[model samples]
Structure formats: C-alpha cells, structure tokens
Target: MSGLSVLSGGFIAGLFAAVTAAWVAVGRTVGRRPRPTTAAVFLMAILLTIAAAADVVNAYFSYLPRLGDVVGAATEGGSDPHLKTADLRLSTTSATLRAHPRGAVLALPVPDRGSGFGATTALVYLPPQYFDRPQWKFPVLYLIHGSPGIPADWLRGGQAADAGARVAATGHPVIIVMPRMSHGWLDDPECVDGVGERVETHLLRDVIPTAESTLRVDSGWTNRGIAGMSAGGYCALNLGLRNRSVFGSIIDMSGLTRPTHAGGLGPLFGAGPQAQAAMIANSPDLYIGGLGPGPRPRIWLDVGRHDRTVAVAIYHMRDFLDANGYPVQLHVRSGVHTFTVWRPALREALSWFADDVARVSAA
Candidate 1:
C-alpha cells in the first residue's frame, strides 16, 4: 500500500467511492428523525469528506507520496544526544552494485557536539558507482529540505535519491546527503547562528566533518556543493556565500532574500542590540557586496517563471553577484515553488555540479 500512488486512477476512484458511500450513509440518517445517533453519523460523514479532500490536495502537492511517510516523519527523531560517526563500510563488490544499480538510502544518526541537535537522523544517498569504484572519491552534495520538513522530504517528495541516481548514470555520480535542518516541525531557524540555535555551526562543524571522516568523499571545497528548496534554498545561499571556502557551488531553488519565519525574527534572534547585529550578519543581501577578494563560489539561482514574487525579488541578487564578478546562473522555469518544479531542478543541478567537481578534480 505504501508503494501505491495516490494519484493513480484506481486509488482516486476508490477514495471517491468511499466518500460517496459516506454521504449515502448520511442521507439515510436525514429521514430517521433528529436522533443523537443520526447527528453523530452525519458529523462523521462530513469529517470523512473533508479528510478525503485534504488527502487529494496533499497528493497533488506530492508532499506525502506514501501513507507510511506520514508515520516516518513523526518518528524521525532519535534518542541519542552524543555526536558520533556512523558505523558504515563501503562495499566494492560488483554483485552488490548489480543487485541495486541505483544505490541505496541509509538512515544514520548524525549527532553533533557543535549544536547538540541530536534528535534527528540524516539520509545519505550512495550511487551505484560508489560501490563499483573502490578508490574513487566522489563529490558530496548536501541537499536541504524546506521549512517544517524532515530529511526524508527530499526522498519522498523531491525524489532526490532518484535524481542523484539519474545523474550518476551520466558518469558524474555524487553522494547526496540530506540532513535535518530545524529543531522541530514548524521551527524555522533559517540555518543561522542566532540566539540559542547554532544551526550554521551544526552543518559546518558537525555534519560536514563527520561525513568527510566516515565516507569516501572528496574533502576539498571544490568537490562539495549545496542545494535546497524554499526555506532550505535561503539557507544554501546564505551558508554558501558566507563560507565560500567550504562550498564550491550553491543551488538555490525558490529561496528568500533573508532569514524568515511566519512569526517574524523576534523569536529567532531575541530582543537586544546584539540580536539586531546577528540578523544583519545572517542576511545575504546585506553582506553579498562586502565579500573580500577570493575565489568566489559558483551559484545557480533557480526560480519558477510563474513565481513572480520570488523571481522579481532575487533579480537584484543576481545583478549584485554578477557585478561582483562571481559566476552566477539564473534559471527560470515553469511551475511554482513546489516539488513539481524542484524535482527536475535537482536532477539537472546534480549533473551540473558533479561535472564541475570532476573538472576541478582533474585540474
């Protein structure tokens, strides 16, 4: 049932049938007087209809591909609070690569001492070439999910593992790792080191170091890239620009100009003069021009042509980066700020980023 597509004709038809049956049961209650049981049945039918409609909307957005994904998100957090390396080993056997050509997704606990945000697990996507080539060091691409999201969002909604595998087939394979961004559902840290949340330190200090030590990936900045969608996109841009020595490239898909939250920045930075300064430090637009002389990282700003609000806002950013002599690409495609647009973008970006990594490695 988990593999069943909610958009499939059979699945939609069954949902419609169930909803119709529920209404029919409610209709039968209408002529039986105003009994309490009749009212209860009518209420239940209304709830069923609403829930069915909600599921349809959810399917359209591709947020939850499988029924099991809902349960997985709720139980994604771990009990371990200590930062440690995952006990994993690389398999170079040809039989293992033949058995699973696309590669596999590993769920590992990535507790970090930097931020102590240890209640989550990171998802790693190892391409088939990882097992086929024993001595080759693959480029690492860190993919971040949107707000109110978990690491599995990239797998279930964005189809990130499938996208990475497709790029791998082109002989430019990359190790794509999705790490937990926020402390909780609806908690939007915007990947900044503000107040009590040191999200930036978590990714830079803990996640990257542990992955490099444990995995057979290139350790140089030129062999590393970062990409994200929505809130995660903002993070990719902010973190990549702020730490150019850490990431060689950045792919921002439908991101904002600065750190944002539905509740505003008050909760994130707190109330103080230092808080205001931190907010200024985190905003990419404010500091993009101040970046000193160095080899600037290549950046790709992707937004939907139909998404006018974000597309227009990021134009000045593209201009600023261009004016500063940084290599930047602005990609405008059809669709909005959802997975419908990001899924294909991730595939193309993985290929492009991996190719650049290969070129630099060859150089």
Candidate 2:
C-alpha cells in the first residue's frame, strides 16, 4: 500500500467513527420531536461517511486487477519493473521476445516520441494460451484505467486476470494491453494531444504498434476492443467512437461527458474556443448525435446507480446513443463508482467482446 492509501484508510476510519458516533449522540438527544440540529447532524454524518469511505476504498486498493494474476520480472528487460525500470527497446535488429507463461503480466517500458510525454511502462497481460499456442494469433483489448491512477491500477484490482482466465478456459484468448495514461496520477491529459502531451499519439502510434509488433495479436478492428473507467472511460469512448475503423467495441463506465480535473476544464485544456473544440471533438455524445448512415462499432455503457458524479451524464449518453443511429447497451448496476461494481461488469464486458470477436472470426 502507498502512504496515501494508509493515510486515506486512517482518515476514513476516523471519519466513519466520528459520523457514527455523532448520529448515536444525536439520536440519544432527540426526544418526541426531532431537533433541526439533530436532523442536520444525522444527514451530514451519513452523507459524509458514505462519500469518504468510497474515496478511501478506491484510493487504497485501486491497484489490484479483478483477477489475482501473477506478474514477473525479466533480466533482458534491463532494469526491474518492480523498481519502475526500463525494458529492452523493440528493435528491428533484435529477435522477437515471446510471451512467458510463468506470469500473466509483462511490464515493458515503451517510448513515445510523438507525444513528447516521456517514456511509460505498460502492463501487458498474456493468457496461458499465448505461451502454449505460439502459432495462433489472438485478439487484443486496450483496457485503460481511471485518471488519478497508474498502469498498475488495472493489474492490482481491475479483476482482468480472472476474466481473462475465464475466457481462455473457453479456448479463446485475448491480449490485454494496459498503458500508463497520465505522466503522473495528477497529470490529466484527457488522453488528447496538446501543447504538452500528445497522449493519443502515444497510445495509437506507439502503444498499439508496440503491442502488436511484440505479440502475436490480431491487427484488425474486428478483433480489437477498448474500455476504461471514469476519465479513462471518456478516452475509450473518444478513441473507440472516433476511430471505429480501429476498434470493434467499447465499454464506457462512469465516464464524464466532458473532461474535468481537480481544477476543472479551464485549467486542464486551457480556457477558450480551443477548449470548446477539444471537448466537442472528444465527446462521445457529440459523435453519437452526428453519426452517419453506416453502422458504428458496438458500444456498452455502465454506471453505478449510486454514482453521484456521473449517473445523470451516463443516462444522457444512454439516451443519446439510443435516440441517434448508434445504440449502446446500458447497464445500471447496483453500487457506486467502485471496483465492487466494475469487476463484475468487466467480466460481462469481456464475455461480450469475446462473443463479438468469435462472431467476426466465424464470419
């Protein structure tokens, strides 16, 4: 656990106890008629406790993949990924490094000259089949994580390893590529190219190419899917919808309709027409509204009913997708914006995407 996680847990424990104590304290004081102060204190305590607990939980364990898969270190990669080190750069002159079976995750340090965002290490998940059947190519899924998070977030609590194992057990395998999004947890690029960061270029030009070239994975849209959470969900929709020719399906979860940060859009994208243009270009709502005659890629949208921040926005997106030519599967789960909801939904999504991939292959 990070220091933040410990600090967060301590904070939440104090908060939870304080609120519960307050409610008890108030309840004891209240008589036949409820006092306004008592009522206010009770409501405040309940709401604050819920909000604080959710934040603490997400912060503490956001590093686990939904499935508990093992990760390994390699010597050829130069330094250790455990120490946030680099790997051998992919060179045409060098031999192709095959996926290993000892571990499901291979951390490779990838560079992005186009983005100018500095080099980032991606956590790539290889199924058992990847090693057993070296001759068979597999599908690819570009799974992204929430902003204010790192690439390791997907591995630690996303439950992807469990879902991948389930899929592989069915005689199907997919390469799951999780790239580090922000330079740091606080750096929100909105997954767009701008004055400082050309993040989209990093993913499309550098990350995708690196994964495809390094692994025996399919290179077509029919075999590819994109999904993310929160800000990452926004990127999945932005990248997947705009590049329908590249992604066959997308799972958007608890994503905002527009880009926002701890500061707000004004500071993140700069305040003006350029920001407006960026939002319009990146908004899936905008894309769905102007969708053309041809069928677009499959879209799945899910949000916890109790997702205070994005429940309404998700509903609006669901309506937009339905009313317009493009239709999405809207799943309103029974929880807030936590992995408690996402892990199960992710299982369904992988199954759904695999079905799509299977159908395309059969056709």
Candidate 3:
C-alpha cells in the first residue's frame, strides 16, 4: 500500500474509535435506564450512518476521477493566472531560455525536416538559477505531454516551468524540455524510426542533439531523464527504455503499458503484421523483458489507485519488470486519471530526478 492509502486508513480507524468512545460515554450517562428512548437510539443510528457515508465519500474522492468541475476558475483561460508575468523574464545567465516566465506559451522554431507536419516545436523551461550560475551546465528533464495537448500542455496544465523554477530555487538547477509528438498521442507513430512520419527519429535524432548543442546542458546520459503524463508517459517509457544510452532515467506518471486493441493504432501507423510487430516492440513492458538484467535506466512507475482504465496495465508492467529482474521504483498513490493527480505526481517525479540526476552527473 502507498503512504497516502495508509494514512487514509489510519484516519478512518481513528474516527471509528472516537465514535465508539462517544457512544460508550453516552450509554454510561444514561445510567442503564430500562431500554433507551426510541428517539435517542434513532438519532445515534442516523449519526453513525452519516459518518459511514462520509468515510465512503472521502475514500472515493481520494481514489476516483475528479468530477465536480471540468474547468476551475483558476484555469479559466486554459492558462494558470497565478503564474506571474515577471517570472517569464529571461535571465542573462542562460541563452537557451524560451517562453515568458509568467505564461506557459512558448514559440520555438521547429526542425526544418523529419519533424512531421513540416512543423516541429519544442517547449523549453529554464530554472531560476539558470541565469545565476553561468558556468554550470544543468541536467535536462524532457517531458512529453499527453494526447489532445501540445508541447505547451506541460506548462499550461502541469505548470512545469513554474515547478522547474521552484526546484531551481532550491539549488537543484535543471532544464525541462517538452516536445510536441506527432498526432499528440503515444500510439500515433508508436515512437518507431519509420512507421508513419519518423517521430522517433525526430525526437531521438533531432530534438536531443539540438537541445544539447543550443543549450548549456550536460551532454552525458547521466544528466538526462525523460518522463510524461498519460500518452506522454507511454512515450517516455518507450523512448527512454530503448535509448537508455541517451536517457539515464525515466518517470512514467499514469501511462498505459500497452496500446489498446481499439484499431485506432492500426490505421494511424499504416497496416500489416510487420507494422503491428514494430509497434509492440516499442512497448517498454514487451521489450524490456528481453533486455535481460544489466544496468537498465533508473525507472519510476506510478498510477492513481482509482484510475480503473490504466491502473491494471501499469500493474502488469510492474510485475513484468520485477519478474524479469529489472530494477524499478513503484508507487501506487491516491488519485485518478485527471490533472489533480498528475499535478502532484509530476512534482514528486521532478524531485526524484533532481536527486538522482545530480548524483549521476557528479559521478
């Protein structure tokens, strides 16, 4: 069980104990009178029922998908208003700084070719200390956003840049890169070299090299980590596992282990068993098993307990990794398939990378 679950359980148990003690006190105060008044008994039963219902609701909220409001007032314009405009100011400490610190919108030139759609853009986040330490080459964490979202999703919804700035303020300087994947979905091209548009090539060949060359970043794999949310999570695991030489670690936050059989994947990539086989090969759980031991990248896999859709798949992937003797850090927490869960998950993942990447880079 995860820490959140354990804490919730303890809270519920304590509530029950408190209620029991109250009941005993009331019974003793009644002085064992012959048969308690019907009204008093009825009131006690109602209160107990209410308490039970509250506990159930609390548990459900803790694990199930958030359903109250689709868009909160805070995200009114699909952007976080809390992010200050001054935060967007670029510091002279780094030349790679992109996007206004206050807003999530960023406009970077896409690679000329092989980027699919003739337009390839990257979302860049520079830490607050990036300008303070001109001599330091900070590590990089490349985050891929999920479907129906562009490169700016991490900045807009996940508030990645702000989070990066906060971590940087703590003295753990790093850069966060969010790239726009073809079609905005993981199974779109299956992250293969030449499936439909060469997205894998664009990312591994073009994006990484361009970032290293243009930015003041550490070029070694030890200083690099990849991660994502939802479909992006799937991409992170697939790409990170395959290119372990480039990415030293991976953080998968609420990602599905396998593509759905809904036939969308087939039509999107092309046709035939060869294509299907290629797609399956890119799945981390499917291929990681074959790699067989040795120094695999540091992996962190997590999912919300209430996320019924992908939680089972994540569980299977975790089991597969453990059975294959692969090292993994697994976390099952209280949340569902929504930004509420992803926000916290992303924060924790970043902290994990901050600690691990620093050690690897120092070594």
Candidate 4:
C-alpha cells in the first residue's frame, strides 16, 4: 500500500471516465458491425460495474468520512493536555485560541508580514496522539491550498482530515497545519519571494515561527514537512527547496515547474522586470540541477496521467529530480488534477511522512 500503487484510486477513477466516454463514442458510430459493437458494449458494462464499485469504496472509506468516529472524538468537548495556548497578539481573540482536545480543529492567527492582506488564519488539526503525552512534541506537516481556495478546502474539499485519521491509525504522533496562502480575494500568492505577495517569506518568517511558538510542534527540520496541490504545490516545492533546513520532506501534486500564466503575468506577480526576475528565480527547475548533498530532503512528486494541464511541468520536475541524483518518488496515476488524484496523494504522503518521523524519533 505504501508503494507507487497508492495511486490505484486515481487510476480507477480515470479508467471509469475513459470507459464512460468510450461507451458514448461506440454508441455514436452509425454503421458498425453488430458483433463488435456488442462486444464493446459488454466490455464497457463490466468496466463500468468495476468502476462503480471502486467509486463507492473511495467515497465511503476514502473520501466522505476520513476520520469517522475518530475525528468526532478529537473535536468533541474535552481537555487536551498537550495543547499549547496560542499566543494571540490581537486583543479579544484569545478566547477562540485556547487549548484543544486531541483531534480538535484550531484556528490560529498568523499576521500577514508581507502581503498586507489583513489578518491571516491558519487551520490546524491535532492528532489523537497529540493529547496522549503532555510533553511530547509532535511532528508537523504544513498543508497549503491553491489559489481561489481557502484553508478549509483541505478540511472539506479534500480528504485531509481523513488522511490524518489514516496517519493516526499507524499510532504515530503528527500535527497538520493548513495556512491561508492566498494574498487577496483575486490574488495568486505565487508562493515565492517576490514583489507583491512574498508568501514564501511569510511562510518561513511568520507561519513557521507562529506554529513553533503557538503549537507543540517539533522545531527540527527533520520533523517538519510541506505539501500542496496546484499553485500551492508549486509553493511547496519552492519553499521546501530553499528552506531545506526547515522541512525534511515535501509532496508536490500537479505542481508547476515554473511560474507562468496562460494570460499576461503582470497581474499575478508584477508588471516590472524585477518581478519577472523573481519569477525566474522562483522557478524550481533553475535550482534543482544545482542542488548538492548538504541538505537533502525526501521529495515526492505526483500527477495524473490524464492531467494534461500540469502533466508536462510535473514531468519536467520529475526529470530534474532523476537527472540530479536526488532520491525522489515520482508517480503518475490514472486521474486528472482533481480531488481524485490529490486526496490519495496526500494520504500516501502523510503516511510516509509519519513513518519517516517515527523512524527518526525512535533513533
């Protein structure tokens, strides 16, 4: 289950979609042989049945209720001894930033240090084991959401909580932090150290420090991990690469190799040469080839076979990782760049990260 086969759900979903489309295509042929057509129909019928079963399994166990009773137990009314009181700087907000029970969802205040986009809120999930030992410092995973997305997207839109539940089942201690990555209502933070948003610095400067100070997160770089999808994925790569001293591993799903746009880039980054320069500097492709052995972190990159939009860039990233002698795990599942691909990717990453942390913590 920990192998590349972790992508079976995505592959099955893609196969289902393709078979459903093939069913339509075959039905549309006007003058086809009846025998061949019948065979095609029979094949599609069997495939569809199998696809339906997979979908049901994914929805109930993988998607809908990832945590089930475990999530409820964590969020319910109880005292978590390991919970660290958030150092709320703003007045009248400390009430909402109190100690949480194991598996509780907490809203933490992260001040915007660069983007000037008002006060930021990061949603964090405390695993069941977090409250079991009062003095234990849990490993942390920083999850990022894409543009046009909120912190809650990981909580609701994806199976992050379910993934956490799955991680907890391994009997490891971990913490999940979902920080607000968007700079504005219509902004793409680019997740780079740039002219406008500077979300990268925000993460290294504000987010990490805040989490370390407010939560019972282990500060060692080996105990920290980062991952994101789409734009957030790109950010994860950038931050994890440059801040290798902080993150021990990273998971990039459908991430862009470079910063580009179908439209003009003036709006997203800036309209000046400096912004263009920053974009080029932020391109992970530029740095991948030059990476040395000093600070190597476990890297995982995944994309869907049918995900035409980001597939090319993701492959480029995989190529760099392979060519540069960096030990990486790259997977191409049978899916598009949607939840079908991202959810499982996150789950596998979390599981692997937990195992990695356990091995390190044990040592």
TM-score of each: 0.82, 0.75, 0.69, 0.70
| Residue 185 Cα positional deviation in candidate 4, in Å, after optimal superposition | 5.2
- Model 1 C-alpha lDDT per residue in residues 63-171, reported as the tens digit of each score: 4333545454332212112211222344323343332457666664666765766645677877777777878788899998787666767776687777777888889
Candidate 1 at residue 156, lDDT? 60
lDDT of 2: 0.71
Candidate with the greatest lDDT versus the true structure: 1
Residue-level lDDT of model 2, residues 175-261, one tens digit each, is 788888888764678887755677888888888877888777888877988999878888898888778788888898778776665
For every candidate, C-alpha RMSD to the true structure in Å:
7.3, 9.4, 11.8, 10.6
Number of clashing pairs, model 4?
1
Judging by TM-score, tell me the better candidate of 2 and 3.
2
Best by TM-score: 1
The residue pairs found clashing in candidate 1 are: none
Model 4 per-residue lDDT tens digits across residues 188-263: 6567655555577778778878888877788787899999987778878888887777889988988887765435
Task: Give the alpha-carbon lDDT of every model.
Answer: 0.75, 0.71, 0.65, 0.70
TM-score of 4: 0.70
What would the TM-score be for candidate 1 when compared with the true structure? 0.82
Candidate 1 segments whose C-alpha is farther than 4 A from its true place: 1-45, 62-67, 73-99
